[model samples]
Target: MSYEQAIAALNDQWSQGDMDSDEYALERERLDYERGEMMSAQDAPEVAA
Candidate 1:
């Protein structure tokens, strides 16, 4: 999912308290890592197929 979508989901999860602080932190970190990976992939130069 996109970062915005992930953030929205995280907000909802946070509001629901479905996750503890540690869980929330880990999930957020995972989302951020995913987002960064996506960004890096997007920034990479594409090779001709």
Candidate 2:
């Protein structure tokens, strides 16, 4: 799965209480940063490569 998709699934898991708070927060942070980078790259085409 794509990073965003995986992140979203993790979020769902967290919401469902399937993951602990600490693990959820950490994974959420990782995914949030990754999603930010992905968005930034999308906005700035030169960074995509």
Candidate 3:
């Protein structure tokens, strides 16, 4: 699934009390970091082969 969908699922889990605040925050941060990396890679200039 995409990062957006994964984040939505995480939010649902947190809302349903399946995850504690600490764990949810950690996971959310990790997801956000990964999303940022993916976005950065996509936006980077391509190198000449």
Instruction: Specify the highest-TM-score model's number.
Output: 3
Top candidate on lDDT is 3
List the candidate 2 regions with Cα displacement exceeding 4 Å: 15-18, 46-49
Q: List the residue pairs that clash in candidate 1.
A: none
Q: How many residue pairs collide in each prediction? A: 0, 0, 0
lDDT of 1 by residue, 1-49 (tens): 7789988999899999888999899989999998877777778747322
Clashing pairs in 3: none
Q: Cα RMSD (Å) per model?
A: 3.9, 3.5, 3.4
Least well predicted 10-residue stretch by lDDT in candidate 1: 40-49
Would you give me the overall lDDT of model 3? Answer: 0.90
Which window of 10 residues has the lowest lDDT sum in candidate 3?
40-49
lDDT of each: 0.84, 0.86, 0.90
Q: How do all models score by TM-score?
A: 0.77, 0.59, 0.85
Global lDDT of model 2: 0.86
Q: Mark the 10 consecutive residues where model 2 has the least summed lDDT.
A: 40-49
lDDT of 2 by residue, 1-49 (tens): 7886887799899889899989988988888798889889889978765
